[model samples]
Target chain A: MSASTIIFYILSAIIVGGGLLAVTARKIFRAAVFLLFSLIGIAGLYFYMNYEFLGAVQIVVYVGGIIVLIIFSILLTAESGSDMKKPALSRILFSALATIFACALTLWLIKQHTFHVNESTIIEPSVRNIGRQMLSTTEHGYILPFEVVSILLLAAMIGCIVIAIKIKPKT
Target chain B: MVITGVCLLAFLVVLCFFLGYMERKVAAFMEIRLGPNRVGPKGSMQIVADTVKLLFKEGLTPDGADKFLFNLAPFIVVITSMLVVAPIAYARDFQLWDINIGVLYVSSISSMAVIGILMAGWSSSNKYSLIGAMRSGAQIVSYELSIGLSLISIVILSGSLQLSEIIESQANGWWIFKGHIPVIISFVIFIIASTAEINRAPFDLTEAEQELTGGFHTEYAGMKFAMFLLSEYINLFVVSAIAATIFLGGWMPFHIGGLDAFNHIMDYIPSSIWFFGKTFLIIFIIMWFRWTFPRLRIDQLLNLEWKYLLPISMVNILLVTAMAIMGWHF
Candidate 1:
């Protein structure tokens, strides 16, 4: 096999293994760390595909932002050395069934669609092009969705502030 | 690629050693005391002796500590710092990777250092380490936003995320000079935020010695501790180099629109020299701040970022965006 293909296999192994460990790890902190590895592996996949911006975003948003927050909460709320409570047998069985169904459905969907490799139409995903498309007013532009996402984030921020702030008791 | 990587690693070790010595001298000068005179030529060999001592010392893994993570954390921290050097242009035509999203990559990779710090803290099985790591996590996370926003202003001004292109855009003049008020504001904010992000003095609440006692790496010993110290200096260099690159212009020598003779004279300096000179200048400024300012209280530190730097940077981005669109910048 070619080096690129070997690298791809290794990355996939990391992703899958990390995901498995994240769920099965006895300690919560270790589980979070496993999730971090899984996320980083996904970022590696993005890099492998030459999606540099997307890869960086994956690292910045998920690995740097979300996972750190998750770990912070874990550290604050849980004892690091303690083992997590095992899920009930019924819950495990149901989850296993759900996973199988999801995997089968995904495979079926992939088989139904034929992906065309149109070399001529493939544009270099440079930052300049990304920026132009993001803010462009034309039909293909993502300005509307971009603005919508911003508004959604703003609302979330306000909600978080509201929830976090404690009113002082009357003297 | 392998050769360059090896060379860069070697250079970084030497640079870190020099910085260690420099920090001591700077600290000594500020405190009106002689520092490191016992070693080679006014304590110039102090860091070397210290490194040797650390190498010979044992790296202790405490009882009940998470051994796996404790061993892994220093490597993670060191590797993240090393990774950020990839996109940095040391001189004209002297960059390792001129990736399109260079700035983004630097910010993202640098952010990963906090994970290592967190790992170090959590795995140490010490309360002080845990508290220090948590403080570091909160501080780095909050300051990262301001750093991103400040960098966004430069991206808007340069109209490219590529480092080489950004430097080229500053050929006529540096952004701090060309982009005027907004750029200056962002520059100041970048310096302050980056210093805090790197956990330097005034913002070194992560390892606040008085309270936390060595902070996240409290339980570390020997070469493992050295790795943490090395990473800190490397981070200091990285942030200072970034500040130099974005604000002062990477390897571009000073030039003026209507001053041909002066511009020609400035170009006489080598591109690499220009780059290092600017970087070291910023590094000195950071070191100066370390000596000058008192360590900030945790609440005060959080308040400075969220309430002050964050808002100013957000507004600065808008101003920079307007300037970029209006073709106002030189």
Candidate 2:
């Protein structure tokens, strides 16, 4: 096998292993860390595909932002070292069945789709090109979606502040 | 690639030692006290001796601690710091990796250091370490927003995330001088935010000795503890080097728009010297900050970022964007 293919396999192993460990680990903190590894492995996959920008965004948003928040909440609420309560046998069996079904459905979908690699249309994922395309008003421009995302983020921020604010009782 | 890795490791070790020595001397001068004058002529060998001592000392994992993670934490911290060194332009045409997403890579990778801190804190099974780690986590996450925004202003000014391109765009003049008020504001914010991001005083509530007693690495002893200190100094260097590269023009010699003779004279100095001089100047400024300012309260620290730095930086980006589009920057 080519070096790239070997590397891809290794990355996939890390992602799958980390995901498995995250779900199965008894310790809450260890599970969070495994989730972090799984997320980082996904970021590595993006980098492997030569999508440096996407890889960085993946790291920044997922591994750095989301995982930290998850860990923060875990630290605040849970006994990190204590073993998590085991699920019922029925629950585990159901989850396993659901996972297998989901995997089969995903595989079938992938097999059904005829993927095309459009080499001529592929743009260099440079920062300048990204910036231009993101803000452009022309066809294929991402301005509208970008603005929508920003608005969504702003709304989310306001919502968070609203939820977090303490209401003083009447004196 | 292997040779580059080896050299970078060597450079990191030497730089950390120098920074440790410099911090001691600077603190002493600031406090009007003699510091470390005993070991090898003005205590230049103090850090070396300290390292040797650390190497000999037994690294203890606290009873009931998670041994695997406790050992793993320091390596993660060190590796994250080392990874950031890749994109930083040390001298003209000298950098390990000139990745297109250099700024983003640095920010993203550096953000991972918090995980290591959290790991160290949690695995130690000590309340102090956990508290320190949590404080560090919050501080880094909050300050990261301001750091990213401030950096975005520079990226907007240069119109590229590439380190070399950013430096090249500053050929006529550095951003701090040429980009006027908005750039200057971002530069100041960058310095402050980055200082907090790296957990330096007066923003160092993470390791506030009076409260947490060495904070996240309280239970760590010997070389493991030394690794944390090493990572801190390396991070300090990386942050200052970034400041130098972005605002002070990396390895670019100081130049004027019209003064040909003086600019030519400035070029006679080596690019590496220019880079190091600018870096150290910023480093000294950061050190001066550590000694001069009192450690801020946790509430006050978070307030500074969320209330002041974040809002100011957000507005500053808009101003920079306008300036960039208008061709207002010289």
Candidate 3:
């Protein structure tokens, strides 16, 4: 394998392994911490793919913001540090089966697609280029989706506020 | 790979002394007292002495903590900081990957610092550790929004995601100058948001000694604790470098129209020095904020992010985007 491919494989392992640890760990805080690592690994992949802005956003937003929120929620809930009870045998078996099924579905989908991007296409990392492409009428312009991202953030903020605010007790 | 490895080692070795020296000097200047004049010319080798002390000290694993993660936390903190430096535009053509998504890469890696904090907090298995970790979670998330909005404004103005492109776009004049009022506004918001994001003073409730008692890493001792301390300074360095690269123009020489000889002279200094000079100036400012301001209450911190900076930056971004489209800027 090429050096880049080898690097890719290693980061992929880290991302996947960290994700599993985040979800499956017995302690809630440990899970949250693992999620942070997983997100960082994915950002590394984005950097390797030449998507610098996306990588930084991934760090600033998801790894930095979202996981931090999760940690806060764990803290506020009062259940963060306790040892969670292991699932009963039958439930554990059922959950394991479900996980396998989900993994299989994803693996099957990955196998079905043959992905390719032209290797000769050169690009600049400038915000100016992205802005131009965004506003352009061609295939590379991403203007429409940019507005969508804004709306989505607006919705997220509203939802977070709603979740955070508990109605005051009636006088 | 070999070069990158060497760079990481060099980064750590330099940071060991610089952070140690900066902390002593800043603390001394803050209180009307002198600090750290004993070791190696104004405590230059103080960190070295400290390192030797920590090296000989015994490693302690507290009872009831998860053994595996406890060991993993410090290394993770150092490694995450190391990884984020890759995409930073050290100078013109001196960056690692000048990718279209450079901004995203930086934003993502920065978040990992929070994870390291979480690890230190939880793995310590103390009540203070838990509280500190929780506070860090809330603080980092809230500050990140304003940080993102401010950065998005830069993306709007520079019209590029690459670090090199961002620096190049400001070649004629730094973004703080060339881009309209909104860019300057965003720069201001960004600096504040980043200071908060990195848990510097005025936003350092996570380590509030009066409250959580050393905050998240309270239970840590020896080299593990040292790693946490080292990571904090490295983070300060990384964030300042980024702010300089994005807003101040990384290693791009000053260019006022019709001043060739002076501008050429400005370019004579090594790119790395120019980069470090700009970065350290910002670092000093951050340190000033730490000493000058008192820590914000957790509620006040969240309110500042949500009710103020976020909204202002969003509006500014819209204005800048419209201006960019209308050809209103140089």
Candidate 4:
């Protein structure tokens, strides 16, 4: 096997292993750590695909921002040393049924569709092109959604502060 | 490339040792006390001795701690810091990988260290460790805003995210002087925000010893503890190096438009020396801040970022953008 293929398999194993551990781990803190590893494995995949910016963003936003936030919340609410309670037998049976359905659906979709490789339209990942597309005003531009997202973020921030502030009762 | 990576790893260890010794000396000088003097030639080998001691000491995992994550945190911290070293320019043409997204890559990877800190704190299962990690989580998130915006101001001025291009743009003169008031504003905010980002004193709510009792790495022992300490010094160096590269010109010497003779004299110095000289100068200033100031309260730390640094950085970026649009910068 080629070096790249070996690396890819290793990364995929890490992603799958971490993901399984994240859901199955008894300890909540360990689950978060597993989730972090899973996210980092995905970042490695991005790097392997030569999408450097996406890889960095995946590390920054998911591993750095989201996982830390999740861990912080877990520390705030949960006892660190305790294991999560086991699910009911009925719930486990339902989850097993859901998983089987998902697997069958995915397999059926894959068998029905014929995938074609299109090498001609693939663009090399570069910051300049990303920046231009981000701010451009044409049909393919992302400026409108970008501004809308900024406003959404602002609204969320204000909402958080509003919810956090405690109101006083007057005599 | 392999040789360079190995050399950089070796250099990182030596630099961490040197910075540790320097910090002790500086702290001693500030407090009017003699620091370690009996180790090896005026305590120069103090850090080495400490490392040897730590190596021989048994690694400990606290009873109730998450063993795997507790062990993994230090490695994550060290790895993130090491990843940042690749894109930074030590001298002209001396960078390992001059990636197109150098600034973004550095900022993103450096932020990942916070996750490691959080993991260390949470997995320790100690209340103090959890508090320290939570403080770090809050502080880094808030400070990252101003740090990123301040950097974007510079990116707007230079029209590139690449460190080499940013450094190249400052060849005529440093950005602090040449980019005028807005650059100076961003530089000041950048320094303050980055100092907080790395969780140094005056903003080190995470490891506030008086309050948190050694903070996030309280449960860490032996090599694990040493790794955390090593990453801190490396981070100090990395932030200062970036400040030097972005605002003070990476490896470029002092120059002026009409001072050809003076510029020629400054050019006699090697690029690596110039880079390290400026970086160490910034590091010294950061160290000075640590010794000279007291730690801020957790509330004050958040207020300082959200109330002060963030707004100023946002405005500074707007001013910088206007200048860039009007073709006013160097």
Q: Which stretches of candidate 2 lie over 4 Å from their true place?
A: A137-140, A143-171
- Candidate 3 has a DockQ of 0.58
Ranking by lDDT: 1, 2, 4, 3
Candidate 4 TM-score to native: 0.94
Q: Score candidate 3 by lDDT.
A: 0.80
In candidate 1, which residue ranges exceed 4 Å CA deviation?
A137-140, A143-147, A153-171
* Candidate 2, pairs of clashing residues: none
lDDT of 1 by residue, A1-171 (tens): 999999999999999999999999998888889999999999999999999999999999999999999989888985667887999999999999999999999999999999998988878798777777888888889786878999999899999999999999999
Cα RMSD (angstroms) for every candidate in the order listed? 1.9, 2.0, 3.7, 2.2
TM-score for each candidate, following the candidate numbering: 0.96, 0.95, 0.86, 0.94
Interface RMSD against the true structure, candidate 4? 1.1
Error of 2 at B198 (Å): 0.7
lDDT of 2 by residue, A42-154 (tens): 99999899888999999899978989888888778757788889999999999999999999999999999999998888788887787788889799897868789999998
Candidate 1 at B158: error in angstroms?
0.7
| TM value for model 3 | 0.86
User: Which runs in model 4 stand beyond 4 Å of their true positions?
Assistant: A103-122, A143-147, A150-171
| Shift of residue B135 alpha carbon in model 3, Å | 1.4
Better of 3 and 4 by TM-score: 4
Give the candidates in order of DockQ, highest first: 1, 4, 2, 3
lDDT of each: 0.93, 0.92, 0.80, 0.90
Query: How many residue pairs clash in all the candidates, one count each?
Result: 1, 0, 29, 0
What is the CA-based DockQ of model 1?
0.84
Candidate 3 residues A54-141, lDDT tens each? 6676777787668777766776776666878887899979988999999999999999988888679767755556666778887767
lDDT per residue as tens, model 1, B142-178: 9999999999999988988989999999998999999
